[model samples]
Target: MIIEVFRANGALLAAGDDLARPAGLTSARWQVLGVIDGEPRTVAEAARTMGLRRQSVQQTADSLVADGLAAYRDNPRHRRAKLLAATPAGLRALADVERRHAAWADALAARLSPADIAAATAALQHLATALDQEPSA
Candidate 1:
């Protein structure tokens, strides 16, 4: 089940790459933008939300900022920490990717019965919640 989930997600990520390329963003960068879309967050916060290491998210955030897709905002509450937010370009890119993803999801869903899709989605959500409650290694 885990392998199947990975395979499906991997395929979706691969298809997303094509959509992201025109915006000069990669999947990792897009993920960061999506996370920061509604609110700004420190690199650590973003990493934790995405289940990634701080260093990895920091590297991706740095690249996104360099490309003008994201910007750093002063965090008055934490002098040493800066919050990340998506720039207008970043938001647009994220929207584009979301639309593409939705279309792909719709096409895939058409191949399965509604009941099967609902069951799969519920199972995946249950598994994700269970894993999230586990202690970190």
Candidate 2:
């Protein structure tokens, strides 16, 4: 089960990366922009959302900023930590990626019946919950 899940996730990530290349972003960079699209967040907050280390997210955000894809703003909650937000170009890129993602998801869903899709989604959610309860290494 674990291996199957990992394989699926790896394939999904590879597809996302391939789709993002034309936009001048990688899958990792796209994830950061997508997270900040809903609201501004500190590097730590984004890292936590992505299940990544703060330092890694910080470096990703720094690169995005340098590439003019994202920008940092003053965070009221933390004096030292800055909030990350996507720039106009980033938003445009995100929109394009989101559209492609939706189309891809729809194509996949069309292959399964509604009931089958719902069952698969529920099972995946349960598996994710179970995994989340495990102790971190």
lDDT of 2 by residue, 33-135 (tens): 9989969899999999998999999999999999998999999888988899999998998998888878888898899899988898999999889888988
Worst 10 residues of 1 by lDDT: 15-24
For model 2, the run of ten residues with the poorest summed lDDT = 18-27
**What ranges in model 2 sit over 4 Å off?**
none
Candidate 1 is scored at a TM of 0.85
Q: Write the per-residue lDDT of candidate 1 for residues 20-112, one digit (tens) a residue.
A: 777777888888998999999999999999989999999999999998889999998899899999999889889988887788778888999
Which residue pairs clash within candidate 2?
Answer: none
Clashes per model (N, Cα, C within 3 A) = 0, 0
Q: Between which residue pairs do clashes occur in model 1? A: none
